[model samples]
Structure formats: structure tokens, C-alpha cells
Target chain A: MEIPVPRPSEPAKVFHHSCFAMNTRFSLVLVGLEAEQARALAQTAERHLLACERLMSRFDAVSPVSDLNRRAADEKVTPPDALWEILTLCQGYWRQTRGAFDITLWPLTRCWREHLQRAEEPTDETIQRTLLQTGFHRLYLDEAARTVRFQSKGMSIDLGGFGKGYALESVAVQLRAAGVERAFLSFGESSITVLGSHPHGPAWPVGVGNLFSPQDAVHTFQLRDASLSTSGTAPFNAAGGPRAFGQIIDPRSGRPIEGYRTMSVASPGGMEAEVLSTALLITPAEQRAELLSDFSAVSGVEIVYDSNAGEFVPRIEWKYGS
Target chain B: MDLDSPSLSSSGLESRADRREFLKRLAVLAGSSALIAELPWWSPLRVAPVAEAAADRVRLGLVGVGTRGNLHISHLLNTPGVEIAALCDDYDPHLQAGLARVKGAKGFSDFRRMLEMPDLDGVLIATPLHQHARMCLDAFSADKHVFCEKSLAYTIEECQAIADAHRGSKRVFQIGHQRMFSPAFLQALELVRNGAIGQITQIRAYWHRNGNWRNPVPDPSLERRLNWRLYREYSCGLMTELASHHMQVANWFLGAHPVACTGYGSINYWKDGREVYDNVNLIYRYANGTHAIYDSLISNKFYGMEVQVMGPKGTIEAEAGRLYAETPPPAPGIVQLINSLEHGFFDTVPIGGPSWVPDLKRDAKGTAITHEKSTDDGTAISLAAFANAIRLGVPIEGMMEQACRSGVSVLMGQAAMEQQREIAWPEGFRI
Candidate 1:
């Protein structure tokens, strides 16, 4: 219900545009440029984002990711150079996060979602069987050949959690290369990146909010030349019930983490911020600091919903940096 | 205006209520048959009185029992106070097939013999383009009403001759631009006339298909006769067959024929010794400085077909049955604040939102204009009108003009493409 209010008269230097792509809204706002020039650059950025969706979407039967899921179990398949690079980056993050971040958990996610839809929890045997098809250890990549192979059948990789961040980073690269000095990019409003300082401020002030009431900010972060990502309980559970369940699943337990909690992480790299946000959400609170030690110049915040009262209240549970 | 509840003021409410009342009365008038004759003589909604007796049945003969002819037969069969008296096709298989569908209908190989049936009240000329002019002239000479399937004739002069002959005669002449009777199109036209989308600036239309656009011929010697659409001598191919429907809509909506046109065409994909271009692109400039851009191809069906009538405020996609506003309405307080700020006024802007939500919902596709279900593209309704007009012996207003304008416009497009220059509207062609 945010009304489009008239702007105060100021220098007519900012250009903004939004387009739907990758199952989310991707927006770009650039400062200190003519409207036509900014629009041309935004068009280029949108094309890049659309291309990423074409390559990464698992729902599209003809996408490369779908082809990999269908064929990689029996033979090594060489991917396009860009996809190969992304796979390499994912592998590095999987190892760095100590298996906290995983793309091969689609089988477990599907099992839970289907059982939840049936109004039943997955049987223990079903969970164990699906777990066998997951785990980054079973996925092998040949560096020289730029090929990928999955050791187990029924294994699939879903980039839904990470594709947005990657696309934002890719667009940022394109915009910066085109001599765009100051710009803001947001993906689904959950992940945001800034190219330079704000026009009238030192940094772009972005607020981390209660997931249920997004308009009320619980905390604000000064984002400058960095990206911020948030991971939390979905607005509804898998069966579309209001009683929320966390979307972040613990890889070791093979079950969705039980809580109404959210984690926000800021890092210099878009991919790093996205991975660490989800990784930190499922990690033990005491061990969260140790997880952050592996990355540099990163800040983290964890907010847990206190439901003792009649209404849910978001309270900051932990903070890693000022 | 309160930001929380942004309802219209008293004066605004009064004006809106008055407008709604006016539109409601207009809709009632349009739906009532009693007021149809009082409508403008050129209005498509004008209706003739219905037949009241069994002897008032209009006996009709159909020429060219091809694809279009069969569709017309199906509709005519269901129409009240109508009889299919004769079916004619030079091709024995089509003639026999058409005769089989309509019981007790006499079959003839020559359309002239069918025209000689003195009892026939009308002749439905569904023949190929090259045969339309001759068949229509013959039917008119025999003093029979004519409902010729579209792209009126094969040549400009033939279209003029058909119109000229029908002008002095008491025959009820109608074209096959069924969209003229389409409920959706009528609703779209109503919206346009009411200034729902503002002054018309441009129209863009396209029709696409992925096929060879051919009919299976049992024998090679019947190639030209069977696949008549693929030969230049028989038809104008995609221009007459497909683009004409959209061109008729363009002319009808703009209320004027195009002043001039230029275009390019080529047989790029289906080059199987076909004489017509498989692809065509054309631009028609109107006298009002607006232009209609049109294109058609048989090699790609991705976009399918659509006729988008666009203005500054919004676009009415008549084919898709949707209207998309250029900009969604902003909140009232936001509008007021913007206006104040533009005028350099210091105002307390009342704006608030729940934190961390997406700022706006993206709507890439427009909303549907109406929810009423209609399975008509105007063919059924057009035939009913034709039958009613014939029975009442009343000529349909604007029917001949619609036929001439669209028939001449598409032929001009073909000429522009063939002669490699802009073709003006046919001179001295009165409709």
C-alpha cells in the first residue's frame, strides 16, 4: 500500500526502471546520468538478467540445468563457459560453508513439500532415502574439461536460492563496465547491491525488516559498494498455511529448521552475502561467529520472533558487528 | 482528500454517476432492435425487421463450396427463416460434399446455372479471389442479394464495379468482415468513442502461422484449383486471406480509409514454386497523420494474431480482448503531493508503508476488458444479420463501404509490394 508520492523538486538526474525476470522483480536506479542513457544501460542489464534465467531456470525443460539433472548421473556433461564458472563458484562455497549451503537438496525439499501438501510429515525412511540423493560430495567436476557429473541418480540442482544474487552481481558488472558510477539494484527486495555512494548521502540506507510486516524496519544498514541478503521463514508454510515454517533446512538433519527466525548478512560480494545469509540461518547461534571468521568484511544479524505474547514480535537475537 | 480512504469528492461523484447513467442508456439503446433504424445509416448495429411468416424465408445459393463456403453453410443452416437452395463448385468432390451436408439442396457444377435459379433470393460468393468479381457481377445482374466473402474481389476495378452495381439495385449487399458484428469489437468501439483511451495515434496488427498454407491435392493437375491461395493469379495470399481482416478493423476504427501505403513482401520460407509471398510487411498512412503498421508471415506462429489500437493514454488490444493503461493510477495523496512539489509548495506528504516489502507489484500483462464469455468471431452474428436483411429486403447500411474500403486497401498493399512504390487509394471509387 505504498502510494507513489510526488518527489521534491531537485536535480533531474536519477533514472529508475523495473522489469520482471527470474520469477522476481529486478530494479535499477542510476544517478548522475541522462534519462535516455540510463534507460539504454538498464535495457542492457535487463537482457543480461533474462539470459541468466534462461540458463539457470530448472522449470524450463530446455535449460542447461534441467539437461544436467536429466543426464549428468550417467555421463559427464560439459556446460557452457558461464555455467561452468558458476558451478565452480558454487563448489567453492559449498566447501567453505562446511556443507551449510547446498544445491543438491532438491530431492529432500521435494519430499518435504509433497508430504506437507498431503497434511503429513515425511516418514523417517523417506527422509533417509531422499538424503542419499543429496550432498555436494557426490557431485564431481573436472576442471580441465569443464564438465560435471553426479554420482547418484535422482539428484538435481535448484538455483532458486542463489540465481537472484548471481544475476544481480552480473548486472552490476555490466553496469559498472558501461561507466555507470552510481546505481542501486534489488532482486525481489531480499537481495540488494549498490555500485557507489548515494547521491546525497555517504551510503545507500537499506532497512532489514520483519518479514511479516516489511514496511517496518527493525534495523538499517549503510550499504556502499556491497550487497546484503536476507533469509528467513517464508510468509506461509509449504501447504500455504499461515503458521510459518523456516525455509532454511539443516543439511545434517534433512529437515526444515524449526523456528520463526531471520538472518541478514552483508558482504562485499553478492554471491558471498547470499550464501552466508542462508548458512548462518541454520547454524547454531554460538557457532555463527566462527562461521563468519571464514569470510572477510562481513556483518551479520539474527532476528527471532517472540510469540509468547498474543502477537508475534521480532527481536534481535544476535549481532556480529556494529 | 484523506490518504486512508481516497474516495472521489461530491462533484466528482456526481459527474461519474451521470456518465455511468448515460452509458447504461446507450447500451440499452444499442441492444434494442426498435431503435436500430434510428441509428446512423453507416452504423454496423443497425438491424432490419425480422421475418414474421413462413413464406418470408430467404432462399440462398452458395458458390465455391470450399473451406469458407462450408463454414457459412454451417451458420446459415442454423439461421431462422433461411433455406440453402443450391450449392455450386466446379470441383466435383467439394460440390458433392457440400450437397451432402445440406439436405434437399440441389448441386450444380457451374455457378451460372445456380444463379439462374429464379427462386433464389441471395447468392453467397465464397469463391476464390479471382472469381469473386465475376460471380458477384453475375449474381447482381440476376438481381440477387450478395454476401461475398472478404477481400471483395481480385482487382480494384472489380471491387468498384461490384459496389457500383449494388448501389442502384435494391439488393442487400454485405461483406465477410464478420468482425463488424463481433460483440467484442463492438464493445471495443464503444470504449474508443467514449474517449476511454484518448485520441487514436496508431494501430499495429500482425498475423502469423507456421505452415505451407496449402491444401492437399489428390492430383497434380488440380494444384492451381485446389491450392488457389498460393498462386498470384487466383489470390493475393496472406494479404487478402489474413491481413484483410485486420485492415478492415483498422479502417472501421479510424473511420477513414488509408490515404497511401508502401510495403515489402517475399516468399522467404515456403518457396515451393508458390507465386505469392509467404511474408509481407506494410505501413499505411492516414490523412490525420496517424499510421497503421501491419505484417504477416506463414513461417512463424509465435505471436499469432493481434490488432492493437494504441493512443497516448492506453491501448485496446481488440484481438486479445484486453486494455492496458499506460500508467496505473497512483494514490490520491501521492498525486496531490507530486503536484504541490512541482509547484514549489512546502507540503506535509502523508506516505507510509510496511517495511521490507517490495515497493510495487509488477504487472507485465494487461487486464481483460470483459469477463462475459463469447465464442463468436462475428461469423454467426454476421450471417444472422444477412439473413434478416434479405428477408426484410432492406440493404445493410455501411456494408458496401466496409467491403470496398478493406477490399481496396489490401489490394493497394499488394500493389505497393509488387510495384515497389507507395500506392494511393483507388481513384473515383465511390462507396
Candidate 2:
């Protein structure tokens, strides 16, 4: 019989703060501070996070990303300086991942999702048409004009999970510069970043646990000043075998990667972890190693859900060393 | 820590064995945008409790030293800027027991003498329901601030008298409806007020338990004192002891007292010659024609306890700290129509690839109003608020009215059940 799982002992004086931002809840854990001071620092971090969310949230009508998606098709839109840097960084990631990490595939994603919701496949004609509107190469960023323009009409860019990682990295930087030595921030339990080490250990032993049994650690990451992001497809039929409801669309195939699987990646930066987790999931098996080799101190794991077990059982299909 | 669960991801934040904080986080994350006003008394929660000097501490005297009183003592002992200066109980053993917990606290067999101590900043009355009114009036007459426990008083008149005494006083007069300070309740309140559940058309609340509500009495002579909750003279059975908490939440959300109430009661179980009924069911009608239905029994624990606020848009289980929408937001009228037909998500697409169709997932468990998963409830935070209010010398707004509305409402319930007729809310009450 399985014994009740125990949450590992926590260190003293860890103050927590939480707020709703980015259409999601953001939680912060700060250790070894007076409660009042921790609250102040967390509030500051929250402000920084909200600011980043305003810059990137595609759902926010007033957000710069939304403005870009609205006008960049016909006329050039000069993004804010900070956003321009983010766009350039995304372009870098797009090149590094060889288009696997493109953010311009939201139209294709919407198309696939609409068809999949009805348990039907979109026609090849429709996929080909959506393919025209996607691809990061089609979105031009002119360095001299500092303006962004889209090559096709009805094309849109969505930061999606990337926005959460960006917000986390931004807040983490603010905290580290503010002399915060130990902290934990999580957005929607998927994107996580930590500062310094755990109060009781040399590094924070953050574990990826079962969704139903949250304390049962399936895998543990002894992270020191690192971030982890998990990108996955939900099982289309949880009780049935091998069916997947696509979450992250593969920009190359113009369709989502087939199967119920997740890719978890850890890196020194939250944005890198976020980008690589999705990129690695879509990249072919042989190309994954070369894709990850470009980054320092990065590790990746693929957990493929075997639904034949009656209950969806996750098995590690692939692993890459940090 | 586990990165698997949203609730446990940062459970370390509330460092104490505080499931309350955990529940609050759950509610917030589950999308209960807690819209509680940033009241001043909660400053103690945000600010350091021990940082204030001893002179700035609010010295308090506790009158009752029984079950609830000892719970308060445990919280007050840990609360910052508060000192338990005196302990009082007519029962010498209870008084001694309380005194042992707080070193240097003066113990008195008579509560009146403890009220005379000029050093005490406030008095917390956690005595029997019958005694709340007298102690509150005396404490007020003595010019000490008062924090009285729930089910305010023995009768409607006494409830009025206590509120009247605290009316113009500069001192803080807080009624112990701790849900007022509960993070889960606060989150639930925000959802209700924001029209997340739309206009509340009805409310149904229930508290069910299988065991006989009794404390083991040391002797036959002490039965009334130790197990007073089961009696009519000293209490109104489950109504005042347990039902009042839910009543307070309902009244606060409804924003009005029940104009009339009717109920039925009977001593159907645990017939130990107890005067009060073992089971009771009541309906309170507010002026707006909406009704709050409540029921409790000491025979079935199946339903447990819950306060469900329902409207056309959704339903809120306040005690459970969850909100369920009739249709998940962004679901258009046609989607709702499809939902009513009970078609699965994978049903054939009836419309063309349209732009406005929502991506809907059929869900039933409802979103948790975070922090509701806490065993801490709001007792400790309410104690901190009490001490903070004493230090600031400001009364809690609507506290007396909350006390009277729920307090009198229950009394009305008791009367309706006992008298076998509808009982209207007391006319010309001064709360």
C-alpha cells in the first residue's frame, strides 16, 4: 500500500503573497524576511509582472501585442522599446529553434482547435491557407525604422505561455537587484522561477508531481537560481488510449504534435525554459539534442502518457542532461 | 515543495500551520477575486504584530474560560500588540486553567471585579449566550472596549440593549462573527457583490451533524454550565451555537434582516431531557421577498455544513468556498442553449467555422474561492482584528448590526419553532 506522501520540511519565515494577473494567479514565496518587508517586495514584484503582462497579453485589447496584431498587417507599427527588444529576442529564438518556436502560428492553432473541437479534421485546403498566415519569417522587424509589419493579412501573434515566463523573468530580475536572496514565483503551476537557494538546503528541491496527488513527486529538480517550464497536450479522452487535445501547435507541420505528451525544461532563465519546452516538444527526435546544445545548463524531459493503463500513466520517453 | 499542485506550490507563504492562508490562495487562484475592503483592523495581518512597544499593546480581559474562550486565548497569546491582563470565570477550575496558560494574568472568580481593572483596554465575553448581554452592558458601563462572541444575546431586547450601549462610545465594540474576517468568506462575498452569481434569488443553508451536541460534564451539577449549548435557558441549541454563523453570512450578503421567520423543531433524538430541540428547520423572509432557508439536525451528518447563495447566473457555496457559473463566461446564448440540451463537447459542429464560437469545457466541480480550504477559518485573524481595533479605538462598521441581525434572526427562529407559528422580526429594534 502507498503511504501518504509527505511535503518536505519547509524552512522558517517564508512569507507568501498572491494576486491575480495575466488572467491567471501569480504566487510569490519570499524567505527569511520580516512579514511586512516581504509584502512590500512581493507587491513591487507584482507591479513589475503587471507591467510586463500589459506589454505582451494578446487578450488585452489595449496591450501592445494586440495593437501589433491589429495594425501591423497593413501599416508598420513601432512597438515600445522594451517590447521591441522582446520581439527581437523572439526572432532570435525562432532562428535558434529553426521556426519550431514561432509565435505567429496562432491562426493555424485556432483553425486546428475549431476543427478538433468537433472531432473532425480540417481540410488540407484550410491547413494550406492557414499556413500562409503563419511563420515568423513572414513578420518583418525593421531595425532602422524599429517598426513591425506582417507579410500576410489575418495573421496574429500570441505570446501564449511565453508571456508568463517573460513576466516571471522580469519580476525575478527586479527581486535579485533588490537584494532578495531567496524567493519562489509560479504562474499557473506551469512556469516556475526561483532566486538563490533553498533556505534549508544548498538548492531548492522543486519537484514535478502528480496533478491529482500534488505531493507525490514524479520527478525532483534540485534547482539553484533556475526556472522550469512544462508544456504539454491534454489527453483528449483521459480514460481512453493515446488521444491528444493539441495545446502547442507545431508551426512547421501547421498541425499540433500528435499524442498525449509533455515536455518539461529547466534553464537559467524563465524565458529560455518556456521557449525551449514547447520548441523541443515539436522538434524531431534526432534534432532535439542539437537544439538544446545551443543553450547552457539546460535540461529537457518528455513524458508520454500511456492511456492503455486505464488511467493515463506518464512514462519518460526521452531525457537530456543539464 | 511540490510544483504539481497550484494550492501547494507556495504553501510555505503562510508559515504557520495555516490552512486558512492555503484556502485563501486556492480561492484567489480559482478565480475568487477577493474584493474585501482593505479595512484598518487587518493592518495587524500585514504589519508586524510584535514590533509595537509594550505600552502600545492593547491589554485585554477574558471573562469566560471554557472551550471557545480557550481557543481565543490561544490566538490572543500569539497575536501581536495584545496582552491578556486578566482572566475571569465563576467556575474556579476553568479560571485556573485559563490562568495557567497565561503567566502573570490576574484571575478572578467574579467577572465584575475583572471589569473594574483600569489597566485592561478591552473585555472579550465568551460566556454563555444568556450572559453575553449582561457582560457586554457592564463592560460598556465600565468604559472598557468589548468584543462579544456570536449569537449576540439571550433575547431580542438584550441584543438591542447591548448595541444601544455601544452606540456612541469611542471604544471599539466588535461582535464575534469571525466569518467577517474569513478570507474564504471575503472572497465569496466579493463574487456575490460583483454580480458573478448575478442577483441572488434565494439562499439555502444547512448544518448537519450525527453526534449529540454535548460536552462531557464532570458532574451532574455542572451539566448546565459545561454543556449549555444544548439547553433553551442558556442557549437556543444549534441555532445560536452553530446556525448563527451561517445566518450572519446570509444577512450580510442579503444586506437586510429577515422581516419574518417560521420554523419547526422537535427533540427527536438524544432525548436526555434536554430542553432545547435536537433538530430545527426555519425559513427567513427578507423585505425584498427573497427567502433564506436553514435547517440543522443532530442525527445525520450526510450534508455536512454549507451556505449556498444561488442566482440565475450561478451558485456560490460560501462555506465550501466555491462558485459555479450557469455558463462559463464568454459562452454565448446559443452555447448555453446547447448546454441545456446536454450535448457533449464532441457533438457535431452545428455552425460553420465562425469567429464568435467559444471554446467551452464542461465542468461541474466549480472554481474554489481560495483560502476556503483552511481549517483556520477566520478565528485567529478576527482575534488580531479585535486587538487592532482596541489599539486604534475605532469601532468596526456594521458589527453591531451584524450581531443583532443574525442574533435576533436566530432568536426569531427559535421562537417560531417553539411557538408553532411565524415570528416577525422585533418591531422598533434599535440596531
Candidate 3:
């Protein structure tokens, strides 16, 4: 979103403006309140103060080269403090999830991307090579110096799963600090974070759009001061595009997440919701409920599975309170 | 004019009449000055008395002990001047436990039956959310004081009825949203109201929890019917159970009722045939053109439990127990001008008939106060205040109607969530 260019002499009230961009496939909103509320939220996103959004900018720098790209020959290997903090957070999550949400699978992702670009499937040998290069335990993080290194040079890290949610969290915190008591940071159709509240309505009226029909919202969610993220194969696979080929890779078998079209989680923080959304989808149908209860951030969850009946069936939806 | 009578001889009659008049006038003057001398210069009307009664000796009774009701009894037993007089629960085990705590106190299943017992003076209601109305009505009918749990009642009609009952009885009635009595909350409220920070434009509140509903069934025959809170038949969900306290706080600070509301909820967890929401988020629009947002979930515990009040002058974070204000000291130029005057530089200047200058007031201090103890002391304080009001016959505002008004906003939030439309405040709504 373009930053609001304020004319100095204008009698400024709050200017509620939203910007749309394709990188994250969502919108950045600046709600110019009577004072500095919107500006504060914007700063939080820009500064990467939030764990979710902070990953996108710096993870790319630290990730191992998927292919030997000459452009990264003299690239700085060490990430900044902010990036290091995020990596540290991810490392802790890796231990917590036991590699369910591993970030060190960029090499496999790249290989799949190459195959998709060529409109062909990867050969067994190529798949085997990519699998060998990806393993959560293979990424070595140096705590003392705050650096990340791969056990094998081919190992890489990509933070695509959790980045947008973290960014929304950062913006929400900024909004709280800036005195904009409530707002919603909507990241395309994938996620939303309620900073404070709505101006004259309920928490926030969220439209849960139909997977088959993206234009129609089949259900609605009332949300406030919480982060809600949805992970689904439908967004990618709708047009059968290259990005859809094998995006949701299963850490267990190193293949696409099968039989799940959409999975959504409500959490107190964006990054927590993002990771859990992905993890819940890839979990076997039976163990999904038990696995979701492990995180305190998860308040409610809705998991949809692609049933053999040619329709997505709601496999599990659990809320915290009765 | 009666000169003919011997007693009315002009000079003698005049002297007699004057003598009588003098005595009567003397009495009148004496009475007037005496009345004037008896009046006090200032009465110093007492709002609350510190030394009126001992806290340990007051007898308390449980009128409708339920979930939060039991919690009240547990806390009250620990407080001074509070002793459980009788146990009044519709169910057996709850009543038994309460009676056990206050051995020998009377036990009655019906609240009115308990009220009729000569020993009871005050009643605490912790019944189903809907029962708050009828029980409070009975408590006030018996001329006993009341302390009803939060979200006071289930509907606006019930809220209004309770308010009328409280008003008609002229008895002390305190709602269970006890945070009102918490020192931190009180401090935060005062700071916001006093504009310590500035004009509060918005407020955010949340209470998130992760769990399933598995209360010990009161009766096997009742089954799901026994746990009324889990169903719409008895309770208001997260809004009533959790958001009520926070919403009341916000409403109190805003000094108004919500103008409108919009929200949504769903039954995603523990769908063991429960009607009340498992998750809810509500936003309220106040008459002052401000807003309050409340959210809660039953499945996750990553709780952001706080009330953030944002204002133009400063921000008061209730959870943090901190008040930040924009008290920039007088600018240096202003300071220098005052300094010059303090040194008698302004003595030669003509100014409003006298050379007057002000000091910097440099000792102004700002520090964040973290509450050392749990602010749950509100329950005790509220009880004490209610007792004091009953004993002293003092007027207490924000009775059941205030609770009802606050509750209506919660219901409105629910309505918004269900209907996906704005719920406007009814015209001439007192609460």
C-alpha cells in the first residue's frame, strides 16, 4: 500500500486508507484516526516489530541458495538482530512442533517450482535429491553469534507460511501503541488480525468465503483483538497454476498436503495462528484434535478435508470454551 | 379611642399596652436569635464512614449460589465482618457445601424461604444468567440487600425489571462484575475520567480461554438441562460470562450506554448439544461517539486480558496499571521568562497592577504502579460497600439497571453477531 502523503495545511482527522499488493496477496490498511493511530500500525508493520511479518524481509537473506546463484556470491551471510530474533523464535517453534512446521525445506520447494514452471513432474532422482537437502534438524542455528547455517550447502529456509501473519501482528501491536484501540489487518483471504475493535459494529464481521466459489462468502466470523489465519490448498490450486503445484509440502513424507482444502485457526498472535493452520491441515485426521490442543494460542479451529465424495468435508472444528 | 372606660384613661392605657407589647416582642426576638444560633456552619455530610462497624461480625447469606456464586461464598468467608449466615442453593451438593462452610446456618432450597428466616439481611445471587432477574426481584421484595453476578440478567426486559425492583425497594444492590471494586481498575477508571491522559476515543478488551465444558452434573436425570450455562436456555455466553465486567468498565469510563453494536459467534468446540456461543467478539458504540470492543474464545489460552483506553492527551493501560500523560514541562522560553521573573526581572514591567510570576513546579512525578496483590479484593470491597449502604441508608447508583444497561450492550453484541446487523439502542433507555 502507498503511504498516505499528508498535505501539511489540511485539517487532519483520521484517514482510514487501505493498500492492496500482490506479493503477500493482501491489503495494508492505515486508519488515520483523529491522532496517530493509523500511522502507528503502519510503523509496526514497516519496522517488523511483529514476529509474522518480520520473517519475509530477512529470511530470504539467510536462506541457503536453492541453486548456485552467482548473484548471492558476495551476499552478506549474517542477518540483522531483528532477523536473528525471528530465526530464534522459529527454532523454538521447530522444537515445539517437532519438525511439523520446518522452515528448512526451501530446496524441495524450489525443485517443485522448477517442475511446475516446466509443466512437468519431478523425476524420482530429482525428488530424492531435494528430499535429501531438506530436514528441520539439518539447519544449525548458532545462539552465541546469532547466525544460521545449513548442515549441507543445498539446505535452504523459506518463511512463506508464517510471514504475513507475523506482519499483521506487528501492525496490531503498533495500533495498540498508537492509541487506535481497535482495527483489522486483513492479509488477503488467508489471514486477519483484529488490533483493537470496530468503530460502530461488532468485533469484526469476517466473511469466510466459499472454497469453490471465492466470490461468495458462505460463512462469517465475528472477531476482535485476535488473529485469525487460514491455510488452504484451494487458493493455490484454484487456477491449477505453478504456485499451486506442491506449495503445502508435508514435512512427514515430503509431498503435498493431501485431502485438505482449507484449515483456519484463531489465535492471540498472527505467527502462532499461521503455523498452526498449516500444521493442523497436514496432521492425520485422527490426531489433529489432540495436536491442536498443544498450543495455548489456538482459541478455535476449523479444518476442511477433501472427501472422496468430491466435496470438502469439515473434518474438525474445535473451540476452546464450551 | 375607648377613653370612656376608667382602665382606658389615655396615659394609663398607653403605658399598659406598651408593657404587654414589650414582653411579646422580647419573646419573639429571643426565639429568632436562639434558632439562628442552633444552626451549624457546615454539616460535613458523610458519604462513607470508616468506623461504623467491625468487618468480621457481618452475617452473609447465599441466595442463588451457582458457579460464580460459589466463588463469592469462598471469597466472602475470608473477608472480615462477613460470616455466611445461611446456604440457599436449588441443588443439594452446592447447598450442602455452603452450609458446611458456615456450620449450623439455615439451609433452604428456595431463596424466598431463606429470606423469610429472621437471621438473613443480605442475599447473593449466583444462579442461571436468566434467574438473576427473578431472584433479584425476590431479594428486593424481601427488603434484603443484593449482590447479583455479572451480565446481571439475560434480556433487556429482565434487566429493566431488576432495575425497577432495586429502585422500588431502595435497597443496596451490587453487581458481581467485581472489578469495579478493584484498586487497579478504580485507579485506571479515575485516571481516564479525570483525563489524566486525555479524551478516550476507543477502548479494547479481551478474555480468551481454552477448555471444554465438563461441569459435574447436578443430576443425572437433568443431564444437559442441569448445566444451564452451556445452553441458551439459561446463560449468555462469553459476552455475559466474561465481557460484561470489561464492558461495564468501558461504559463507566465513557459515562454512557453503547449507541450501537455488531458482532459474531460460533459453536466450533464441544458441540455436545450446547446453544450458547463457544466464541464471541463484540464492538459497542457509545453515545459519546466512542467505542469499546470485546472478544473471547473457549478453545485457546493465549489470552490478551486487558483494557486499553486510548485518548488524545495520554493512554491509560488498565492491565499495566500505568497512566502515561503528555505533561511536557513549560517550554524553555516560558521557563526562562518565569526564571527571569523569579529573579525580579519582571518587577520593572507593568503587568495587571502587580508583577506576578509562576514557578516551574519541577517536582511533578510520574511512575508506573504495578498492583502487588490480586485485584480480586473487589468482591470484598463491594460487599463491604453494600453493607455500609444498607446500614447507613446511603444512596447507591448503578444498581441493577446499570447492570442491565451494561448487559443490554452485551446482548446487542450478541444480536449483532447473530444477525450480522447493527443493533441500535432503544430510545429513552434509562440504563
The most accurate candidate by TM-score is 1
Q: Which digits, one per residue and each the tens of the lDDT, describe model 2 over residues B1-431?
A: 00011231222334333433443343343342344342333443443343448888889999888877887777776666778999999988889888999999999888899988878899998888899999999998899988888879989899989888888788888877777877788778778888898998999999898987777778999887778877778988888887898899889889899999999999988898788888999999999999999999989999989999999888999877888766434212223212322321211111110112122223333777764455557776677777766766677666788889999999999999989999998899987
DockQ of each: 0.05, 0.01, 0.01
lDDT of each residue in B304-420, candidate 1, tens digit only: 899999997789999888877654343332343334434434333222111122233344436576543455566656776777677667788877888899999999999999999
Ranking by TM-score: 1, 2, 3
> Which structure among the candidates has the greatest DockQ?
1
Candidate 1 A-chain TM-score: 0.93
**lDDT (Cα, 0-100) at B99 in candidate 1:** 92
Candidate 3 per-residue lDDT, tens place, B75-107, comes to 555443456788787777767877776666789
Error of 2 at A43 (Å): 46
Interface root-mean-square deviation for each candidate? 8.6, 17.2, 28.2
Write down the lDDT of every candidate, Cα atoms only: 0.77, 0.76, 0.59
Docking tier of model 2: it is: incorrect
Q: What is the lDDT of residue A249 in candidate 2?
A: 82
For residues A1-322, what per-residue lDDT tens digits would candidate 1 score against the true structure? 2223344457436666766677656667677788899989988988888899899988778999999999999999998888888888898999888899987889988887777777677888888888999988999999878789999999999887688889888888888888987877777667878888655456655667665565466777777898888886463263344455666777788988666887888888889889998898888888888878888889888888777645668898888875
TM-score of each: 0.64, 0.53, 0.49
The ten-residue window of minimal lDDT in model 3 chain A covers A63-72
